[model samples]
Target: MAEMIVLKGLIKRFGDLLAVDDISLDVKRGEVLGFLGPNGAGKSTTMKMIAGFLTPTAGTATVCGHEVTEQPVEVKKRIGYLPEGAPTYGDMTPATFLDFIAEIRGFTGTERTKRVDAVVETVDIKEVLCQRIETLSKGFKRRVGLAQSMLHDPEVLILDEPTDGLDPNQKHHVRNLIRDMAANKAIIISTHILEEVEAVCSRAVVIGHGRLLADGTAEDLMARLPYHNAVAVRVTQDNLSIVQEGLSALGPVEAVAEAGGLTRLRVAADDGKARLADVAGLIQDKGLAVREVFVERGRMDDAFRDITKGETMESLHQGDGNA
Candidate 1:
């Protein structure tokens, strides 16, 4: 696939703070790449650089082959950006705001009118088109923002927290819009919602503290973390120490907990399918009544927590000169 967006050794700094470290990444044409990171992890900084809103202190970025710094206007022309808060002209109606954006994007005359109307309808904001943006609900306002970003029909879209304040129905609608747009445009969605990543993004890149941590498909990322095939077993019992000890005797157990008359154990092994059967067999042989045994599949949330927690702990230790 062709690369629509590329960052080479990208770096951004604010005095003593390095907002974005040297990072290189690529977004393929017609692909939705989820950019995920904890707060202050440089996700927004990276997106800003890509959108030509901020110049990288060092390194370079390209949008549709145009260097973001050297040809910012050209890059901006080919890309649509929706910032973190989805800011809009509060005083202007959806129709007015979109028309303003269309003018700035160089749309004119009948072309501009048609484009504005198309986007307003595409976002399903017809009823709220004439209402002041401030009067519209958060969800409707977000739709207006989305419509403006897409008015020019840019080939690349950079959306930061696109569904931040949207309701469930609106979120679903926006997700569908993004998926539909991915057929013809390269999109980068920066959000903390793990389920959204799984739902809309074909690939994901995880960042932490101004550095890239992991990049791959959801399944691939889950496999990279330890305990990918582990399973959690819960048994109804007052005391889990004995049960934990018994389970540990079989193989390596990751965790054990007992609360509210339920004992939970996480077992780790090379073959999860076989390990589950072994565990059940052992529990039966030991004459313990097993309440439930189920495989626990690794989720994106678990992987994100592990990566960010490790990064946080490492950063603290580094500051303390411990590592």
Candidate 2:
């Protein structure tokens, strides 16, 4: 796949504070990269630089072979960007707003009309087309913003919280639209919603404290979690200790706790190769009555919290040591 977006040692500063700290990454065509971070973690700042909305304090960003600072117009022409909050003209209707965007993009006459109509249909904003932007619900307003960004049908899409304020069905529709467009475009979506990354992104990038933390496929990131290859063993109280010892004897058992009115024993493997057969065999060997047994799947929410929390704690510890 062709590299559509590239960042080299990207840095952004606000007064003395470094909002983005020497970050570098590549987004390729046919890939939907999820830019993830806690609030104020430089996700928006980096996207702004890439979209040519903010100039970098140091380093550079390029979209579609055009440097952002040097070729802002060219970069803008090839990228569709939905900024945070999806800001729009409160006085203009959705149709008029999209028409204005189409005109700004240099489309005119039948071409401009066609583009505006197509995006309005694609984003499903027809219901609210004539409503004032400020009068529309948050979801409808967001769709209007989306329609504007997609009006040009650019090769790259930079969306910050694209599905914010959207209902479940709307969110699903937007995710599907992103997937459909992923075949030919390089897309970057910044969102705090972990489920969105799992559902739509081909790769996930995590940042915190203005620094890159981790980058990989959703499943790849989840595999870094401690829960990876962990299995939950539930048994009767009479067999709690017996099951714990039985599973522990097989390898290493992580923890034993109470959950869902049963004793839950969590067993883990260093390599994610823990087998259910071995665990069931141990139960049979020990003559223990197993109430329920299942392998724990890695969860995005758990992985996101753990990664960000651990990084924050580690950074604080380092700061204290320096002090």
Clashes of each: 0, 0
**Candidate 2's error at 43, in angstroms?**
0.1
Give the CA lDDT, 0 to 100, for residue 44 in model 1. Answer: 99
Clashing pairs in 2: none
lDDT of each: 0.83, 0.87
Stretches of model 2 off by over 4 angstroms after superposition: 236-238, 256-259, 284-288, 310-323
How well is each residue in 105-133 modelled by candidate 1, as lDDT tens digits? Answer: 99999999999989988889999888999
Where's the lowest-lDDT run of ten residues in candidate 2? 314-323
In TM-score terms, candidate 2 sits at 0.91
- lDDT, model 2, position 297: 73
Q: How accurate is candidate 2 locally (lDDT)?
A: 0.87
Which lDDT value does model 1 have at 302?
Answer: 74
